[model samples]
Target: MPASRCGAIRRADASENIWCMTEPSAWRRARAFSRGPESTGHRLTRRRRARMRRLAWVLLAGAALPLHAQNPVEVDAQHYRLEYEDKQVRVLRFRLAPGEKSPQHEHAARITVVVSGSRLRIEDTDGAIYEMTIYSGHAERQPATRHTVENVGSTVYEELTTEFKDAASQPPKLVVKAPPPPPPPPKKEEPKKAEAKKKEEKPKEEKPSVAASAPTTPGAQPAGTKPAATGTTTPTPAQAPAAKVQPEVAAAAPPPEPQPIIKPLKVRPPEEPNRRRRKSFAAEEMSEATVNNTRLAFMEQGKGQTVVFVHGAMGDYRTWQLQIPEFAKRFRVVAYSRRYHYPNPSTGKEEDYTYEANVRDLAEFLKALNAGPVHLVGHGYGAAVATLLAERHPEMVRSLVVSEPGFDKLLDEKRAYRSHWARDEIYNIIRKPLSRQNPENGVRVYHNWLAETQPWQQIDPQEQYERMQNANALRAQTVDPTAPAFNCEAAKKIKTPTLVVAGQNRSPNSAEITGTLAACLANSERVTISEAGPAAYLDNAKEYNDAVLSFLGKH
Candidate 1:
């Protein structure tokens, strides 16, 4: 009970005791004196104060009462039944008797009925008013309303409310304020003349290149390899001799047909350096260095050229389950979950998982397993990771196959739709429960996160749970909104033969961003995988596998 009301009740109790203790005849005899009416006035004042206290007590008691009380007059009876504890609604009934009124309150949603006996008038807090003469069996939808119900009749009134009390219990909610749609992607501008000036300032023939010194063909020798001696005479084969004296031979030799010069075919060497190999999975070999802190759990299979698969956010090596068996037939395939993914305990530190850190981890992992100069294949965020890896460790990557990196650039390009998606997607899913102020709702946020991404749709419920655990660990490492425009310059410096694939009809922004990245690269091209999405690998394993294999080739 409210403290003020409790105090009032105590005062009323004391007053009642005092009245009870006084002998009734004595009290009545004292009340008979009107001369010097001061005592009589004091007695009247005391009675008024006691009555006021009793009224306050009743109001407070009603407010404090549990909603489950059988008394319909209890302030929250219907609200508590609908909002908290679940109850099924069969038929809702409301009854009002003569000369009674309802306390003022707001109704949030439409309900099925308002019935009244005798004449009644409802005045809303907003000054809107309605009058109704209710009878025994009448039923109708209540207005989206806020009001006080009053009885115009001569007797006390009663009210009954019926509603659908049992809504399926929903998980606690979160309120993810949809991020403002990113600004429209900047329009592409043609390279300026100043760009050429910058280009000219730098010396040409930069970096180590075998092609600069070595002969173009395997059998051709470098310029310095053949010594040029002064006045050296070389013997010529005896003149093909007069063998042409015959008429047909004479015609053939008429003018030694001018020899056609054949230029050597120049082939560029692999962009990355070769590294040592580890035992294959079919042989049941395990690397000494673990992917996380645990023993290696990845399967390394087949043996020709090497292809390392990196899974995306909320994914594990199993995401490559279908691709592994197929790709492994023609190439060494190795897939592993990074730390905090699966079979790995999350370190839960943002420092442990920057974009740079992820790339570095892949580098170390490759080194530990004696696998490098690898053809790296990545999906979604994994593509971003792979691109960074190739940029930083160019010597370790032979070629790269990246698909739908899920860069924020996509949302930035399609700002309008992204904004709507964020609101509709996150409001109903993440923000509502959060507005209710419950921390148990964090899990709902994670689930909503998975729902936002396309890949999660293909995963099973058990897999979803496991993936959520990792996402939770990494959630702290959100992209810095103002971080410098993506490090495309860094990525462009990579010379690996890179194939960028985007899924058509998935995320238009994804495709656009993929095109932008490919355009920015020194040796990259983009392709759209028809009818595919973020997890196209799983959606059409054969097609995806074939594309990767074709791009990588035997080398």
Candidate 2:
């Protein structure tokens, strides 16, 4: 409720009895004029005043009514369900059963994470109708608006929508204006003629006494009085010049009465039940922090040579869940979601999601951790990031281990994936789906694209969750404007010992890519593990860990 409205209500309630007490009762009506009958004009005048009082109350009540009366979830519980809410954001799980429709409801500015995609028609607040397809694991930022949804598709439309509630980032609401203060006291007239006459006579009468009170000696007056030469005391009316005496009179006058200090009664906003729970949930999950002013979600454990885990495409910090535990037993491990992945909010603009942005985030992430010269372990797209980090900032890396690295910069397009079936299959799996904003399908393609890799079930549940969380990141990974270039010659110059691991069950195409990369690095060694496919770390954990541990031991 607005402050103005609340006060209006309070004022109305306080004055409700005042009208009855101050106004005459109808029972106190006077006798009819001429003791015959009351004039119709007089009766009408009384009735009009009574009607006006009732109308004032009606107007006051209408003003106190809320601006927004409909609570979206409460009004349309079937379609809109509160997930988690807080002062900062409100998380809602919105869905419609197949063929189901929803009534109009309002939503604030929000970010929507689609769990299931479908074709749907919606009527916006302005009464415009539009049809759009929502894809699973796809994310979008929406401004505040009202709308109704109909699940035109056979399947349900599921979304995890988070709305900001704090004026949606707008300025704070204006406080209500208070009632006017009472009128100030009236001014008083100056002194009368009698007082004025006395003021003139005082100068003449006091001059002699003032002089008599002073010492006869030229140098000093009485001990109780200040000497003329000292000038510390205010001069008397009789001895001082007329102009000086005027200043004395002004100074001697008493101060005016102070106006009472009126401080507004501070009204503390009531705690929202939903928001209270939301904050509790946030406390349990990953605590949010920032890097380069960009918010990041991460977890850290252990206390040795920092082993920073960088994830690949369609992946996040959770991808390293298995590695972190095992490695943290012997070394410090840091796992973090790259920008726009999982809990890490998106920068939103498509142009912001680029390889350069990823690298810059990675650099700042490491700097924020402040664990100097870390041992780098990265998988898939993460492996590519590790490669870039090592190349550009070699001093920050003590040793490097990259699994199934995705550096196509070293590829001779015609002889490599370009003319080959690998490129075509890869495109069919990821690219085509991304064209339609369907990263869910792309995620399946990525995990199962290489048959030689471990079975999908072999991946840890937490890693799977991370992958699903960042399914939307797949498109951005494919569309990065600043794709990295692999330099075989530069790799040869690196003094940092590097271990490149590949899946023993990987296809010939996978082997060729890794083999070429390892050959480029003079101090690097290539290891092929038979335990898993392209993703040796997850598909073949035991062998992969041994390989990494052994290599880390040497370097």
Candidate 3:
């Protein structure tokens, strides 16, 4: 709690308060009215009243002095735990009542002021003493001390303590008086040593019945022995909490192979019109074959070799919003939103969202439209889809440029991988529902994960939060399907030229995985995009676009 003096002035109205002084110095006249010459019947001179008032001011100032002069904290009077000295020292104050023994304890250096009463018995390993009539206002100082206190007083006792150093503030040569050093710690007696001592002390006093008595050493009593009345011997920890006999439980036969426990797949109903309006941006002239039964909205205008840009998960063609104009000038660019996204509705089932299904869909769309051997560029989750497509249909992929595909190489089947997979799997399952249940708490967890991952940190706060929401929502819609459906193994079999670019700010897992993917491919290159994150294409658009253009031209 802040000191009362540090608080702002009260806004309370003072009109009804006759004793209220408008300012700190107004106590003078108020005091004069209360005290005046007993014989003076008429109104006194203003100067005389002022003189009397001045005296009142002096007294009031004295009474208020303590509030401003010293910082005193009233720690609990019962348990001595306290914080004082402006967070410098922790003070603990306790009082032992009559016939009461304080628990064996220790103090780090302290000074005590005796308030009243005595017959205080302070005990140590050496001996104990009873001090009589320890007067009030007496201060006792102890340094590096350990002892137990007992109060023999009939009435309540009190004490005030102020702690200070055990040594004086001067050089050893100039120092005069200092408390004697505390006694050394007692040597420890090992259990073996104690057992040897016991054997020596009771050489021939042994008896066969001693085993029965042995269990009950000093205070322990066996059956038929009188029960102790005071300070009962607590049974040895092993003897206490006696184990009770429990009825035998027969082991049940193993469950009958769980009956295969196949869960019926829950078919998702067709999405609403609003949900189906998928949007895609294309920067090339579209052929008639491209306008098929698919709910794909595309805008195209450009020239040169066809370059189709695939956006990632929970993303529309808008991801290439910045690249369309630049790439259209050189390459025939086409950006298309995936099914089930805005402006276009998907006719296919939930399987369409799977990596294979997505890649297949893009391949079919490209083939139908006669978009052959087109250079492909994708970002983040989209990069994963692009990799699968390139792997599966190597002939169709002229060259591939994927930026920051989130694949973990270290996350193979192992303790570390299993733990991460479990966490991510649980996160995938519960994130959406949990976030919807409590947004603030959900965002907190998201940001905590974000703080650990560089890609997340590179994103703006608003974007990061939105990404979390979108990811959670996407997870909600597409329940747990499968783990890593992308054919990384097929990547090695791919004969198409490949370019894998990763952001430096992101965890190296992406680049490392990409490196592995590139090594698997017949012709592949691994590159790093500096000052970029997971969405490197967007974070550093021009640099990334140029890199892609250059890679494709060379390939």
Q: Best by TM-score, which number?
A: 2
Ranking by TM-score: 2, 1, 3
TM-score of candidate 3 versus the correct structure, residues matched by position: 0.43
- lDDT top scorer: 2
* Clash list (residue pairs), candidate 2: 312-381, 312-382, 452-533, 453-533
Q: By TM-score, is 2 or 3 better?
A: 2
For candidate 2, what is the lDDT?
Answer: 0.59
RMSD of 3: 33.5
Residue-level lDDT of model 2, residues 452-551, one tens digit each, is 3333455443333335545545555555434466657766677778899988766444566788888888678888888676667767677888889888
TM-scores, all candidates, are 0.43, 0.45, 0.43
Q: Please, what are the lDDT tens digits per residue for candidate 1 over residues 316-344?
A: 56667678777888888888666445433
| Steric clashes per prediction | 19, 4, 19
Model 1 CA RMSD to the hidden true structure, in angstroms: 26.9
Q: Which stretches of candidate 3 lie over 4 Å from their true place?
A: 1-294, 346-352, 408-411, 415-423, 426-473, 485-489
Model 1: per-residue Cα lDDT at residue 88: 41
